[model samples]
Target: MDEEQITAAAYNDRSSYAKNRNKKRKSAGNRFLQNAKGFGRKHSFGRGAELEQEEYNYFLEILEALNGMTGDDTEERSTMANNVYAQIRDKEIKACSNQLSSRVLDNLLGFTDEETLQHVMTVFGENFRVVCCDKFASHVLQKTLFIAVLRCIGEMQVDEDKDASECRKKRKSDVGREMDYNLVMDFSPGHRRVCGKFVKKVAKFLLNNLEEFVWDSFGNYVIRQCVSNLAGITELKIGKGNSAEIRKLIVPDKWFKLINEFCSRLLVWPQFPEFPYNEFTSVLLQNILTSLDQTQDKFQMLQIGEKLLNDSFLLKDPEQDQSDERQKLPKVFHRDSSIRLLEVLVSVADPNFFKDQLYKRLFQGNVLLLSQTRATNFSVQKFLDCVSDKHILEHFFSELEVGLEEILQLGHTGVVASLAKACSRLACQQGKFVKLLLEALHCSDATGVKLLTPVLNLMPPEKQSSVQIHLHGSLILQAILDFNKPIKLVTAILETKNDQLAKVFTDPKGSFIVNAFIASKFVGEKSREKLIRHMEGCYMDLALSSHGSRVLELLYESAGSSQKEAIVRELSERVAQLNSKPWGVIINRKLRVEAYRQNPSQWKNSSKAIGGQRAEKIFDDIVDTGSQSKKRK
Candidate 1:
């Protein structure tokens, strides 16, 4: 036989044999849950299936209409949505699974009215277990969940009005909680009824395959969107809702119905210890923890903690004994994947519980050790950030400050950065921290503002053969600037010499010191003015460099009318020189220097103003998420 004939015969034989093997496996109890269906499901269009030419062409026409959609042209949008829905009416599964068509479907979802979206989601629910796990279909499903959440949030805010006493109390609680925590203001009787119905619809889809869903990478992001949006969404409560105000509200506690079910699966998880440690499942667990209420789900939080931290390396201190067993205990936090899970637990954990049960036992004595290692140093930093008690912080400071110099020397300035942030967060003695930081960098004895230079430089003065900047040093300086009693630090900054000031403004990282100082509410107005005066001789120099020009712009925004005039006056003086510099034209126009050249008074009178606080999920770094383009392909 010819070679081509022989090859074709062998390929056909192997394909038939493989099919027989899959059939045998299916009869033996399919372990991979292949083709698992939701109840009575019939329209099972497979994942990434090829589309028929006729359907593909019509969907493209639908896509063209969707892309053309703009404004609140409700009639046209409604017509387009109905036509598209008509195309997919009995074939939702097929429409959702086509890789090219799913992109169009996801956009059409954004344009659909609430009633249409609810119907589409109901169809999604019918085969939620199957379609949510599809590579091509999951994106469309995630987009739908995002819209549902916004609806719930808007609906909850639809109350007729809040009384004055309730308003005052609500404002006080909302203001502080808004800054730090992801709290839902009040899940009062009014809104809980509305949120419960929506949560039920969404959670029902996951319960059938909750375990598989939480661990299914794309599936997990759906849960993350649901929880994170619900947690921080009280932000929307403060907004004037869109033209049609959604007095609809969200119930934060009800989010746990799904979380609790997911956690139950964690207990009997067929995989045991390996399940929580698996990278995908680890992220799912972290997202659930972030949305937990301290009082409502405290037990659940601790239980999940116990499950994750169950191993000796996590729960026990390595130093308690001189055995090899003790040596392995600290290794738990050193792995990149493991450290984040531990940090998430620490952040959500009750302070007293964390300190007594977790912190002192394992991380306390290892402070210096954790700070020096590449991975565990982050754990040290996380601990410092969550710590609030003065005495506990003092105790931590006692250990960390002793090795603070070594930590910096080893290029572990992040540990020091966290310490500075701790000082800002706790309203503790940051002046002392500034002192310790300066002393650690060996500038303690430097004569004056010379100390500030080393910090901005992240190098001791004596060792400076050349000037190089480090970003951490800039962050540390900013944190110090945020301190309540920053006078001591402010004095050092104000004392920065003309030459030193020039160096500060020109360097990309160092120039940020001016913005932080000027923006600081603690610093008096006079300190800011003095800062502008320090830039007087350097305005031409400042406006010429990219970073320096940014400093000039910020100074202008925060500066008084007088400071604005001075900036314009100074820049115009050296306009000719600045016009020739590398970054001049862009900077000049950005700062509106043309106004100074043409008609300065009009610009002076009209001072124009132009304008992720969310903590990352712990397991994000470890996951190998594919790009959207690759997923479609």
Candidate 2:
């Protein structure tokens, strides 16, 4: 507990960090972070390396405890957190390196006073570049920025009121003011000023380090929070003189302009680049562009995509007379990272750009080839996702269907899955797709129809029977079942033998197919009864397994009064046996096993009292909740 007893944090090596930085593409932002000269670093070593390891691991345990501490912003929770905060005050620098310690620190900021926050800001603010480079420390800094964004908005508003009417500043003792603990930032103005000062320092720091933050893996995240979260402080408004209001910017204009410049730089790629693309940069760029798309800035994403895809480096000499070759798009977009970036670009590009330039240049005649290559298969799926026009989607289906079996043979299931979803959405070529799907899975038209088990399991014929179900196969079936109720698939499923059918019921992924079937709008009452009758003997086995219990519940809920009575009666006789398994207790209580065991006649009367209306939440199947919602609505 004594200050003398406190030891230094173990020193971490920046050799790998420096090596990773050298391998990444040269960008202005990364250069600045590389040149920051230990901006947020304080180094001192404790005891021996073994002792330091013990202390570091011990600190992680303490962090876990702090984050797991619960409260509803009550004084008790705050008091408990402060006690922990005091103990860690000496180990503050060391604790920041703990992966999730920031969450506990974040909670502390919300419940504790502004002085505690000021201490945090002052300690960490001095070394933005150094701290932001470590992944875990970056997480803590990001949380601090997020909270500061929310709290400062209120603080800036109060500050603006005083600046606008110089003599009208609200006093701290204003009796009518109420504290809203629900909002962490609606504090006394003095607290607001403290928060405002920290925000100001962050804005200044961000402006100075914009280039270094863009391409550095960990540093890029800090830049994103500043741009997305704290940039809005400029939007605060205040009443000027009489009847008019004007903007009261919290962060200066130069900071925002620099932020814009930083964003614009993220999208640029030269025709012939100096270095290979970095995955971290690709991920960050994707996030920024996606956020732009979501915020209705599609025009920005579209223009950026069009320019990146269309524009290339110019020939040095006009007399070279090779404009076409010089202007040709680079192979950068074909790399795994770039293709993923292109996926987002394709999704948000204008229909004119997507259908015309992309279809002709990237997708038109390359459908099967794209589907065949392992990495490019995703681009094939993206085409299916974005080509919303029936005519375009139809063209895709026609070509993809020709090689459908080949596509399946090669294990490129995502392309197949996306194609199925597209057809279902467009309501074009539904029957043909289903028929083709059979041949594709069977690898022969002659044997396709009878290989339903292989199709359900998404395994080739030799590998089919009881293999765990593929997630994509489940999605495809749910998509098809949503397609106006295909009777061929429905009848085929119902006619399958009980023992074979139970295999699908027991798989975690395959179990959802039962829910989708029962939950689909297409299957009428008689069809439901037929399915239930087929599954009767398998019910007890299904009830005993964990995943199987969910399917058993779905079947019981969808069954008619007669079928419900039968299921309850069967389960009643086996209630003690059913209770032996973990999920058995849940399934038995749900099936009303005890009530049925007490009196069958009484249970029959209760079923009739509901007047044939479907029970609430009973049809809410675990397979795909959206499946039924899509049908009923």
Candidate 3:
């Protein structure tokens, strides 16, 4: 045979061996099933008969194999034996097989006595090494051996009645009875060492598989043991690092719940030690406050805040009897918790914390407590002091702005007026007041007036009469100097009938000011004609007042030639329109006589212009007819 053919045959032979090995394993499993059926019929046991028998036989075979090995080969053979034993004694398979065996035993033998079970467990544990040496041993077998050993120990203690006695003693101690000092003193270091090892192994296992363990059937017991171990670990100097490692394994959400529960348990459990409980509770409270503050969910924050406040109140209250020597006390309130709690409460209530009752309780009452408790609480006081700081003024203004917008949205004119008045009071600076007034103006005319009324009311008593005048006068001047359409402002000013303003216009100090304002309208070329028309209107309105003659004299003196011509033409037209009236006749008669006395040329010229004699005779006849008509009547 050539090399290639030889290799091919070898490959075929290996394949055939693998196939046979699988077939044999399957046949063995089938045989166990048959044994289970037979045992069910003969012993009236259904569950674990076959599995347990198979495991026991597997263990016996490994022992036989180890017994046959030579001394020189013993080391290697022993190693193999141990390996097989571990597989046979595995925890997972043992749990399943034990569950099944317990069910079967309960059905057939009516449950094994604790002594009998202890013996069985001991025998299995003692021979597990031989079972583990077998190549047939699997992961399930290893787990089973481990669990079986633990069960043996547990069962032995029960059979000896020591477990119940110890449990009762522990319970009594937990309930406040003094432990027997001599009995505790008699505890062996060996037992303590063994317990330490056991606890370490359990903690390590749980920490490594924490997620899976937490989801398993023994999750509750595992968590309880883990917490107990963690507490124990914290006490030992060597265990501190391990404890930290274990803590690191916990997720934040789970950690929060665990810590909260731990604190609660400490508060309620009679057996909880004071030092550790106090330490852990402080850490837990700090963690909760920090987490609640960091959580951006406002609703969730509010809920947590309420819980914290209630908890804090309970801690601080003197009536709870929580001040006893044995009680684990809460930490002195650091400013952080106090401030955080205050922020949350105020934010949740949506109260104006700067000016509200809630603010007083937190910033004044509780902060005072914190300061008294903590020497380094100055920073905290500063933080709390910010509660009523001037920064709130800005916030108030912003809210005021928002309130105004709301009023506009609701079309609540009355509310708008009230808010405007409120804003004027709050505005301290001239610029701010002016800006607010402008904003009110843009909102509504009535709102502007309402807002202005307060400002007008607030002017210095001596300056009260001048406030409206100054504002109106300034506005009017602005309108004229800017050459804007002044009609709106003029109409508003006139309609208000501000006596202060009227006085200003009449006073010597104010008259020229008013004239200067009117004169600015003529500064624009386009405004000249409009200015002239406006001036004429003003003069006509003044003419009706007692100041008419004074106003005319001032205008005449102030006018340029072109303005003079315009005013003269306006006055002449006024005289011509009024000539038919009694006042006009008297004025004309007076004017004619004055014209003659002042300038005979103008009088002779006026007399000759209209054929004077006929005009005079006509005037005389009209007068005589009037006299005759009066007599006839």
Candidate 4:
């Protein structure tokens, strides 16, 4: 027979055989469907049921094939994973098919192959809400999200590295590489398949509908991931990096509306429907702050900052320059959310506007009342740091003077500490302001002394000395001691007849004051001598106490030769006595070390010097004494 006639007859035979096999298969599928659905139950092939069943079977078959390909060879596994997803690509699955979609996604997550990642990228844009809202499918979407973010970032990083390499090449060679040259050209086709456009679309969609899922029980987590990571994706496209606010790059109007809505919600006490505080909302707020910081619209930042600081969440039309709503402001910012908003404002808002516009509002709003409440004190401290204008600093303190008694009433150790630290910053630039603050403290009634004494009592006598004193008091006092006319304040503090000076030297809370004073560059020799003499009566006693020993060490290190010699002479008689106490041993070692540092030869040759064996003996005694003390107790 001729070759053409033979080929045609063979094709006819094969076609007839395939038709017979398909007929049998169709019959079997129909029988199985009938049995599964039950014969009495009415069934039809409408609503794409036939196509869906076929697709379902095909999906399962692909999954089954991939399940067997789970060997150690990544290339083989990746190929199989890719092939499985390729079959489902662009095929619509019903909402009821979530479990099937989840399985497919989970398998991809396991492989995390480039092809599988690409498939996920496509599916994400196509079925953004379906994937995000699914009970089980959401997990795979989240994992896909992280993978996409990391991959996109990784691509940008590759581009960066290539640029660096190109630069090195240019320097090493004759000419710089052209900017039009694709940096990512060297990557494999597989590596270059990252869907940045799809990622952005998915991100934009998620952000557009952010409010829907931001408070969802499961959706919130996904929203948080999207807000935090998708910004990088957006940044890569825009080349804005961290300096670009998400609001500007994303839907700016929508972003502002979302932030204002949240701020409004924050204004109401005890949220209706009782939503759990989620990272999604917090991250969104942070992004708003970041946007405010990045945008050149100072007026917008000012308005938002004023609203947040004032806790005025009245829904204002964005087009309007100002709102006329005269809502009664809350006395205290009981909401934890407002604190972070205020913190970011203080950190990111224009310092000038904050000092001028908001500073007056803060005082007039009686926001100082926040200091009295533990919940809002941190925000108050943050507000304090923004008071850099000399005029504002003076005015704020002056106004604070009128209400100093009420302000003092709100002073907890922590609250007072924040005030002290704030005052310290003010003291650095505004000496007159600090003097006014101190005078105000001095003139306030008995309650003022009770309030101010904690600060004075805790102030380290010198600048460098550290104490474990109530941190609030210690910092305030440290600020006071660091002032230009410190002696004026010092003399007043010492003359209070409260043993404030001795308390600083002898008491644990006040001992850092001694270190501060001793380390002070301004402290004259006479003052140092007086400090040493005061401790002389309790020289041994102070040497044995934990906090007091630090005082002795500072004295030894800072004292002149004659004064140091006197300190050594007094301690030398008690050096053996110091051996039994930890604090004593510490002081003895300090004295010997300082003396050695001054005159190494003197310490080396002097038999009385506590070195080598003497120091060892003191440590041994300390261990023995501690053990004995423990046993006795």
**Top-lDDT structure, candidate number:** 1
For all candidates in order, the CA lDDT equals 0.65, 0.62, 0.37, 0.51
Candidate 4 clashing pairs, residues 3+ apart or interchain:
417-472, 459-477, 461-513, 461-517, 462-516, 462-517, 504-510
Provide the clashing-pair count of each candidate structure. 11, 4, 24, 7
**Comparing 1 and 3 on TM-score, the stronger one:** 1
**What is the C-alpha lDDT profile of model 2 across 101-213, one tens digit per residue?**
44345445544556665677777787777678776667667656655555555544455453443332232211111112313234666666666677667756865775667
Compared with the true structure, what per-residue lDDT tens digits does model 4 show for residues 57-163? 55455445543431234456446656666665665234223454445445445344565566667766677787677665576676666555444444455455655
Candidate 4 scores a C-alpha RMSD against the true structure in Å of 23.1
- Candidate 3, 602: how far from true, in Å? 97
Clashes of 2: 4
Q: Give the winner by lDDT: 2 or 3.
A: 2
lDDT per residue (tens digit) for residues 485-509 in model 3? 3343333333333343334344433
The list of candidate 2 runs beyond 4 A from truth reads 1-61, 64-77, 83-112, 134-136, 150-204, 227-261, 265-276, 312-333, 350-353, 443-449, 460-468, 610-633
Consecutive 10-residue window with the lowest summed lDDT within model 1: 174-183
Candidate 4 lDDT score at position 81: 54
On TM-score, the stronger of 1 and 4 is 1
For residue 107, what is the lDDT in candidate 4?
48
Model 1, position 203, has a per-residue lDDT of 68
- Evaluation by lDDT, superior candidate among 1 and 4: 1
